[model samples]
Target: MEASEPLSGTCHCGSVAFEVSRPAFMVACNCSICRRYAALWVHAPPASARIVEGEGQTDTYIWGDEQIEFHSCKSCRAVTHWTGVDGARWAVNMRMVDPADLEGLPVRHFDGADSWEFLD
Candidate 1:
Protein backbone atom coordinates (compact mmCIF):
# COMPACT_ATOMS: atom_id res chain seq x y z
CA MET A 1 0.00 0.00 0.00
CA GLU A 2 1.11 3.55 -0.65
CA ALA A 3 1.17 6.25 1.99
CA SER A 4 -2.02 8.29 2.47
CA GLU A 5 -2.64 11.54 0.65
CA PRO A 6 -5.62 13.77 1.38
CA LEU A 7 -7.84 13.76 -1.70
CA SER A 8 -10.88 15.93 -2.15
CA GLY A 9 -14.36 14.91 -3.35
CA THR A 10 -17.79 16.45 -3.66
CA CYS A 11 -21.37 15.61 -4.42
CA HIS A 12 -22.63 16.19 -7.95
CA CYS A 13 -24.37 19.32 -6.67
CA GLY A 14 -21.08 20.42 -5.12
CA SER A 15 -22.79 20.97 -1.79
CA VAL A 16 -21.16 18.20 0.11
CA ALA A 17 -17.39 18.23 0.52
CA PHE A 18 -15.10 15.49 1.80
CA GLU A 19 -11.42 14.68 2.05
CA VAL A 20 -10.08 11.17 2.21
CA SER A 21 -6.50 10.16 2.77
CA ARG A 22 -5.23 7.53 0.43
CA PRO A 23 -3.17 4.45 0.39
CA ALA A 24 -6.88 3.60 0.65
CA PHE A 25 -7.85 0.03 -0.06
CA MET A 26 -9.90 0.77 -3.18
CA VAL A 27 -12.30 -1.94 -4.24
CA ALA A 28 -14.78 -2.75 -6.96
CA CYS A 29 -17.72 -4.79 -5.68
CA ASN A 30 -20.37 -6.55 -7.74
CA CYS A 31 -23.27 -6.26 -5.32
CA SER A 32 -26.64 -4.85 -6.38
CA ILE A 33 -26.41 -1.48 -4.71
CA CYS A 34 -22.80 -1.16 -5.75
CA ARG A 35 -23.74 -1.89 -9.32
CA ARG A 36 -26.58 0.61 -9.27
CA TYR A 37 -24.38 3.23 -7.69
CA ALA A 38 -21.59 2.55 -10.16
CA ALA A 39 -19.04 3.14 -7.51
CA LEU A 40 -15.34 2.61 -7.05
CA TRP A 41 -14.79 2.49 -3.33
CA VAL A 42 -11.92 3.46 -1.13
CA HIS A 43 -12.07 1.83 2.27
CA ALA A 44 -10.42 4.55 4.20
CA PRO A 45 -10.02 4.45 7.95
CA PRO A 46 -11.86 7.18 9.85
CA ALA A 47 -8.68 9.09 10.58
CA SER A 48 -8.13 9.34 6.87
CA ALA A 49 -11.42 11.06 6.18
CA ARG A 50 -13.12 14.36 6.92
CA ILE A 51 -16.48 15.88 6.02
CA VAL A 52 -15.63 19.36 4.87
CA GLU A 53 -19.11 20.74 4.14
CA GLY A 54 -22.89 20.39 3.79
CA GLU A 55 -23.48 17.98 6.63
CA GLY A 56 -27.09 19.14 6.66
CA GLN A 57 -27.67 18.58 2.98
CA THR A 58 -26.33 15.06 3.17
CA ASP A 59 -28.81 12.24 3.51
CA THR A 60 -28.26 8.66 4.59
CA TYR A 61 -29.41 5.48 2.96
CA ILE A 62 -29.54 2.35 5.09
CA TRP A 63 -29.53 -0.89 3.25
CA GLY A 64 -30.16 -4.56 3.96
CA ASP A 65 -27.22 -5.20 6.27
CA GLU A 66 -27.19 -1.73 7.80
CA GLN A 67 -23.58 -2.32 8.78
CA ILE A 68 -22.77 0.64 6.56
CA GLU A 69 -24.73 3.78 5.77
CA PHE A 70 -24.48 5.23 2.27
CA HIS A 71 -24.41 9.01 2.08
CA SER A 72 -25.80 11.17 -0.69
CA CYS A 73 -26.48 14.78 -1.34
CA LYS A 74 -29.95 15.98 -0.37
CA SER A 75 -30.37 18.19 -3.42
CA CYS A 76 -28.76 16.29 -6.28
CA ARG A 77 -28.92 12.89 -4.60
CA ALA A 78 -25.40 12.13 -5.73
CA VAL A 79 -23.87 9.20 -3.95
CA THR A 80 -20.79 10.39 -2.12
CA HIS A 81 -19.60 7.84 0.42
CA TRP A 82 -20.62 5.26 2.97
CA THR A 83 -19.47 5.02 6.52
CA GLY A 84 -18.93 1.85 8.46
CA VAL A 85 -20.40 1.67 11.93
CA ASP A 86 -18.23 2.24 15.02
CA GLY A 87 -16.26 4.99 13.33
CA ALA A 88 -14.18 2.45 11.50
CA ARG A 89 -14.12 3.87 8.02
CA TRP A 90 -15.34 6.03 5.21
CA ALA A 91 -16.25 3.93 2.17
CA VAL A 92 -15.81 6.59 -0.46
CA ASN A 93 -17.40 6.58 -3.90
CA MET A 94 -14.55 7.11 -6.33
CA ARG A 95 -16.86 8.61 -8.95
CA MET A 96 -17.27 11.67 -6.78
CA VAL A 97 -13.57 12.31 -6.65
CA ASP A 98 -11.49 14.48 -8.94
CA PRO A 99 -9.96 12.44 -11.76
CA ALA A 100 -6.59 13.99 -11.18
CA ASP A 101 -6.64 12.89 -7.54
CA LEU A 102 -7.08 9.27 -8.54
CA GLU A 103 -3.95 9.24 -10.71
CA GLY A 104 -1.59 6.26 -10.37
CA LEU A 105 -3.90 4.53 -7.91
CA PRO A 106 -4.52 0.81 -8.21
CA VAL A 107 -8.01 -0.73 -7.98
CA ARG A 108 -8.64 -4.14 -6.48
CA HIS A 109 -11.67 -6.32 -7.10
CA PHE A 110 -13.70 -7.66 -4.18
CA ASP A 111 -16.24 -10.45 -4.26
CA GLY A 112 -18.92 -8.63 -2.33
CA ALA A 113 -21.48 -10.07 -4.73
CA ASP A 114 -21.21 -13.15 -2.54
CA SER A 115 -20.86 -11.12 0.61
CA TRP A 116 -24.17 -12.39 1.92
CA GLU A 117 -22.63 -15.84 2.15
CA PHE A 118 -18.97 -15.03 2.71
CA LEU A 119 -19.34 -12.12 5.06
CA ASP A 120 -22.11 -13.77 6.99
Candidate 2:
Protein backbone atom coordinates (compact mmCIF):
# COMPACT_ATOMS: atom_id res chain seq x y z
CA MET A 1 0.00 0.00 0.00
CA GLU A 2 3.05 2.25 -0.02
CA ALA A 3 1.74 5.40 -1.65
CA SER A 4 -0.34 3.24 -4.00
CA GLU A 5 2.65 2.38 -6.12
CA PRO A 6 2.78 -0.45 -8.63
CA LEU A 7 5.46 -3.02 -9.45
CA SER A 8 6.06 -5.49 -12.25
CA GLY A 9 7.08 -9.15 -12.17
CA THR A 10 7.61 -11.82 -14.82
CA CYS A 11 8.63 -15.38 -15.33
CA HIS A 12 12.15 -16.44 -16.39
CA CYS A 13 11.06 -16.64 -20.01
CA GLY A 14 9.59 -13.18 -19.86
CA SER A 15 6.55 -14.75 -21.51
CA VAL A 16 4.27 -14.31 -18.50
CA ALA A 17 4.03 -10.78 -17.06
CA PHE A 18 2.12 -9.15 -14.19
CA GLU A 19 1.82 -5.86 -12.35
CA VAL A 20 0.98 -4.96 -8.79
CA SER A 21 -0.56 -1.54 -8.18
CA ARG A 22 0.88 -1.41 -4.67
CA PRO A 23 2.90 -3.33 -2.18
CA ALA A 24 0.89 -6.39 -1.19
CA PHE A 25 0.24 -7.90 2.21
CA MET A 26 2.54 -10.90 2.13
CA VAL A 27 1.54 -14.27 3.57
CA ALA A 28 3.77 -17.19 4.43
CA CYS A 29 1.60 -20.29 4.45
CA ASN A 30 3.12 -23.08 6.51
CA CYS A 31 1.35 -25.76 4.48
CA SER A 32 3.56 -28.69 3.48
CA ILE A 33 4.01 -27.58 -0.11
CA CYS A 34 4.17 -23.91 0.80
CA ARG A 35 6.93 -24.40 3.36
CA ARG A 36 8.83 -26.55 0.91
CA TYR A 37 8.36 -23.97 -1.84
CA ALA A 38 9.16 -21.10 0.57
CA ALA A 39 7.09 -18.58 -1.33
CA LEU A 40 5.87 -15.27 0.00
CA TRP A 41 2.38 -14.75 -1.38
CA VAL A 42 0.52 -11.57 -2.25
CA HIS A 43 -3.23 -12.01 -2.28
CA ALA A 44 -5.12 -9.91 -4.77
CA PRO A 45 -8.34 -10.11 -6.72
CA PRO A 46 -8.00 -12.13 -9.95
CA ALA A 47 -8.57 -9.03 -12.07
CA SER A 48 -5.44 -7.50 -10.60
CA ALA A 49 -3.52 -10.45 -11.96
CA ARG A 50 -2.88 -10.09 -15.65
CA ILE A 51 -1.25 -12.79 -17.68
CA VAL A 52 0.34 -10.71 -20.36
CA GLU A 53 1.35 -13.89 -22.13
CA GLY A 54 2.20 -17.58 -21.72
CA GLU A 55 -1.27 -18.86 -21.14
CA GLY A 56 -0.57 -22.31 -22.54
CA GLN A 57 2.70 -22.63 -20.70
CA THR A 58 1.08 -22.54 -17.29
CA ASP A 59 0.84 -25.91 -15.54
CA THR A 60 -1.51 -26.92 -12.77
CA TYR A 61 -1.04 -29.28 -9.84
CA ILE A 62 -4.15 -30.19 -7.87
CA TRP A 63 -4.04 -31.77 -4.45
CA GLY A 64 -6.12 -32.43 -1.33
CA ASP A 65 -9.51 -30.84 -1.96
CA GLU A 66 -8.22 -29.16 -5.14
CA GLN A 67 -8.88 -25.62 -4.01
CA ILE A 68 -5.88 -23.62 -5.14
CA GLU A 69 -4.74 -24.20 -8.70
CA PHE A 70 -0.98 -23.87 -8.35
CA HIS A 71 0.48 -22.38 -11.51
CA SER A 72 4.06 -22.78 -12.60
CA CYS A 73 6.12 -22.45 -15.73
CA LYS A 74 6.15 -25.66 -17.69
CA SER A 75 9.75 -25.15 -18.82
CA CYS A 76 11.64 -23.89 -15.78
CA ARG A 77 9.22 -25.06 -13.13
CA ALA A 78 9.19 -21.59 -11.58
CA VAL A 79 5.98 -21.21 -9.59
CA THR A 80 3.97 -18.03 -10.08
CA HIS A 81 1.55 -18.46 -7.20
CA TRP A 82 -2.05 -19.59 -7.54
CA THR A 83 -5.47 -18.67 -8.82
CA GLY A 84 -8.52 -19.31 -6.63
CA VAL A 85 -11.05 -22.08 -7.31
CA ASP A 86 -13.46 -19.87 -9.20
CA GLY A 87 -10.69 -17.48 -10.24
CA ALA A 88 -11.82 -14.88 -7.77
CA ARG A 89 -8.28 -13.92 -6.73
CA TRP A 90 -4.62 -14.62 -7.14
CA ALA A 91 -1.93 -15.37 -4.58
CA VAL A 92 1.15 -14.23 -6.43
CA ASN A 93 4.71 -15.25 -5.69
CA MET A 94 6.86 -12.79 -3.72
CA ARG A 95 10.21 -13.69 -5.26
CA MET A 96 8.87 -12.56 -8.62
CA VAL A 97 8.55 -9.02 -7.28
CA ASP A 98 11.34 -6.48 -7.59
CA PRO A 99 13.19 -5.96 -4.31
CA ALA A 100 13.19 -2.16 -4.52
CA ASP A 101 9.45 -2.05 -5.13
CA LEU A 102 8.73 -4.19 -2.06
CA GLU A 103 10.42 -2.13 0.61
CA GLY A 104 8.88 -2.26 4.11
CA LEU A 105 6.42 -5.07 3.37
CA PRO A 106 5.33 -7.29 6.25
CA VAL A 107 5.02 -11.08 5.84
CA ARG A 108 2.83 -13.36 7.95
CA HIS A 109 2.89 -17.13 8.30
CA PHE A 110 -0.35 -19.12 8.40
CA ASP A 111 -0.70 -22.76 9.38
CA GLY A 112 -2.80 -23.63 6.37
CA ALA A 113 -1.88 -27.30 6.30
CA ASP A 114 -2.96 -27.94 9.87
CA SER A 115 -6.01 -25.73 9.90
CA TRP A 116 -9.29 -27.63 9.79
CA GLU A 117 -10.67 -25.31 7.17
CA PHE A 118 -7.75 -25.91 4.83
CA LEU A 119 -7.01 -29.50 5.85
CA ASP A 120 -9.24 -32.50 5.62
How close is each model in CA RMSD to the real structure?
3.7, 3.7
Those runs of model 2 whose alpha carbons end farther than 4 Å from true positions after fitting are 116-120
Tens-digit lDDT track of model 1 for 1-120: 245557788988899988878753467777988888889887765336777998777789888878888988999999988887766667778788878778787777767787543231
Q: Candidate 1, clashing residue pairs?
A: none
Tens digits of per-residue lDDT for model 2 on 32-103? 888877888777862255666677788888777888888888877878768878767777787777777778
Number of the top TM-score candidate: 1
TM-score list, all predictions? 0.82, 0.82
Which stretches of model 1 miss by more than 4 angstroms? 1-5, 115-120
RMSD (Cα, Å) of candidate 2? 3.7
